[model samples]
Target chain A: MVPINEMKSKCRFAIILGVTLAIGNFFRVPYAFSEPIVFIANDSVPMDSITRKELKDIYTGKTKLWGNGDKIVLTFLKQTDVYAYFLRNYVNKTPTQFVNYWRNMVFMGKATFIPKSIKEEDKLMEYISSTKGAIGYISSNKLIKGIKVIAVK
Target chain B: MKKNRMIINVVFSILFIYSAEVDAYSSDTVINGFITQGYMKTDENNFLTDTEEGSFEFNEMGIKFSSAISNNLSIGIQFFARDIGDLGNDDITVDWAFADYLFYNWAGIRIGKIKIPHGFYNESRDNGIARTFIFLPQSVYSDPWRDSLLTIKGAGFYGYLYGLSYQLQIGIMDAQTDGGLAKKFNDITKSSIESIQPETAIIFSLQSTDLIDGLKIGGSVSKWDWKMDLTIQDMPAKSDDEALLWAISIEYAKNAFLFSAEYSIFDVETPIDLYVSPTAAPYRLPYATNNVMEGYYGSISYRMTDWFEIGVYHSIFYSNKKDRSGKDNVKYYNWKDYYSWSKDTCLTFRFDLNQNWIFKLEGHYNDGFYNGYITDNIDKDGNEDVEQYWYLFAAKLMYAF
Candidate 1:
């Protein structure tokens, strides 16, 4: 048996905590998105399209090698909306949680996947075009040269 | 304080390397580390250190080097040093070193000094700046046992099956002779600990992350064995210990709010075949009984702003499951009943000064001494009395890359 005392104190603390959680959950916190995210990859990628589960796995540092045994390189946009949209839709994690996941993996010595952060759309396109097996997300639906906008099923 | 200077140089090296972008995990071989200086004090009673008087003996610094050798193989290592009151004393040691091989998304193996999965955050417990609290709840993540329980030397298997992720490890204990836990063991035996060596260990971890969005439920079970080398009257004696531990954890994160809870138990027996060997004669410590210890806590934290966060938790622990009253110690050792349990209510305020700097303050209302690793009733001044309740205050400043 545990020896935690003071029943009344526990009740009061629990009430206050419950109320705080309710308020925090009631109001929608920022850093959310409804914008569509387009997936872009290099020509060296094995598959022309990807699935939600597959993308989630790749982003979380679970699947490092592609189906054809090529290393999967990941990239992320510096913008908040596109990053939040992509993560929420498939990865089921906030940006903070996503970063922590990778950090934890690094701390665990996995060193498997550390996504390159790109600041702009043109630079992201140029990098993906030049870098083989690289995949990234952009908010723009317009097609760019030297990059394949892989369909997300 | 020369170690502080060395850590400063190391910190600036990280700063110089990633000046343009504060992303330490940018390159192929990620180089990152953190430096922290902390202050600890208590209204009464000493905690880990001379907390009755404010002390800045709390400091930790570590650096990690990690890289992938191939698409499916990687290796990494971290070097760490710390000082908390009279413990650690800035001893530099290898925190963890491992070579990992990935067969598939559902299967990977780690060989070398693999992590021990106790609770949800046990493997990552030493990453202070990466976490929100200066100290995790004492209910399960006891501070004295931090280094001793961090990792084991052996191999580990981890992967995701269907929606369940699992980590299985088979190894030996990484017992340190002069680490924090060894000091506590000294308190337990009232004798000097010469060394603690590994014997046997096995752990299994399982979690379900797909059952709910932003929610996770996990459990871990482990069996651990170790031998302690002690000196009594200049004669060396060896004692053996066997323990079984298990933990259940639940966490949910939504938006900026996070909630977590865990319950754990440790069933321990010393001298597994007690009194059967002549080597155990005249060296056996009293009260080395088969006992079950339990701990649990519920915590909540919210990121109110980009720069600020707040968290609170109520943690509880018991030294013995069958006798929560702890009366036996009084009958045999003339000790207080409260020595067998600990209850703590903690609050913390964290401020992220910048991407690379962090500051935080914390306060705890403590009700017992068992979880504090306080076995002796005497203070540093040899006072034989103790307080039933006390307040502990702590603050920390950290720089990380």
Candidate 2:
């Protein structure tokens, strides 16, 4: 009989391999963590390239309290791998850690929230079209009139 | 405490306005909104006392607006109104009003009266287009028939990366099922399900479609606690009430096949000791008041050479919560017999009228008792047990923009 522990370890390895292969077969990573869609507040904040690191820092609360003294407004597409990529590429934290971190920070009275954290590309477009200080992103294919797209670092 | 909360909310609102101005400078104005209406009639289903039928009625209307103040900063606000139909008066309420700042898509914060994102549905529960039916799977999503008063007032961060979303919130808020008004719309203060309490809750969800087109799966877990003052049976006490909820759901649709299901479990802790009796033998004071709720429904619609398509669905709900000691019960391991369970099953047939409208006829069967231990003794005539059964028929017309 195959050693139980070794067999179990082999089974686990096979499962991991299968899952990884299956995932690899199904989804492809986006060109960057930043969504294809972008937004602008005023002329002072140039409509230009954003470094992935700076983007991550801003989102993760490492860089709280904007120079303008306003709390950062964060928006997100509801649960999607794009969010995972953004978290991994920029925030350098797992989604669970990120959520826990923010919850802890908010409890300490150190942060505020963004009004709309939408998943649908259309809704993200709508946010980009109306709000002033609102910065959001969506799929490139979903792009339409009113919203702007900035470059990623 | 009340005055302090009011002041805090006021202060946050002011801060939001200031940020809004800054956001206006660089952010483009974005406007978004949706409208949904549902019509249905039910005869002797769930907890409704009477059977009634109704035509199409406007169920929800809402608008959300946001703007990016700068490349790294933004703000957003949302306003919505709902019509609960016969469950109560035709009332309108602001569903969610908040401001957010995203330093990046990876991280941001939200403040104001927030949707206490505790499950997969908390934030999107009001969006009608997100679900196929007029009503959601009750036991798994909205248990104890209470949700309107469950939202919170506070601030937290919301972030998404790769394929996950997260939310954490803290505040002094009202509890559901307590029969008090904790939320306000303009000047109208509606009665809430529970009295006010300080609360802390967290939500984390993960989803992926990159693995397969038109298929998504995710899970969420939440825990919250509330402070309560209750007087049951003329006994008064100050207590802490807590509940933990967990759920997992999956969705897949391609061509004509669509399937979705969600399962949720909740454990509630009350504040009372045990009292022994036959029908009311308190199972476990300071024990485990546990309830498991779940629902799954799958449907298929074939193009069938255009013009028309037909679909059928089945859904089930079950709740097992035995309340023995009223408000002062703890989940002690002793009293296990006090728990009871109830089940509701439904079947639906729907017909499509083009891309924007559909008509459905549905029926529900319910086993009225909370626990299987209770015999169906409704008839009392001794010939047969009167089990609860009902049907709902509805026609809906929707326009998507």
lDDT against true structure, model 2: 0.45
Task: Candidate 2: count the clashes.
Answer: 90
lDDT score for residue B12 of model 2: 41
- In model 1, the runs with Cα more than 4 Å from the true position are A1-5, A8-12, A15-33, A48-53, A87-97, B1-27, B232-237, B272-286, B373-377
Second chain TM-score per prediction?
A: 0.91, 0.65
Give per-residue CA lDDT, model 2, range B1-401, as digits (tens).
Answer: 34533553464455445544544222365444444555665553312212243444435554455555655454555554444433322233455556666665447777877765544445555553323444455545443333433466777676655545555665544344322112210001111223435567554455443245446677766666776543333433344667666667776654433556666666655453233443564433333234333433333322222223333333334343344222322233221221222334444444444433444444444433231111112234643232334345554444321
CA lDDT, every prediction?
0.76, 0.45
Number of the top-ranking candidate, with DockQ as the measure: 1
Residues A1-153 of candidate 1 have per-residue lDDT tens digits of 423455644764676567656654554366646878789888889888887767877787666777676678888887877877777677766565466557656666666434788878889888888886788888867556657888988
TM-score of each candidate structure, all chains considered together:
0.89, 0.53
By summed lDDT, the worst window of 10 consecutive residues in model 2 chain B runs over B182-191
Range of the 10 consecutive residues with the lowest summed lDDT in candidate 1 chain B = B271-280
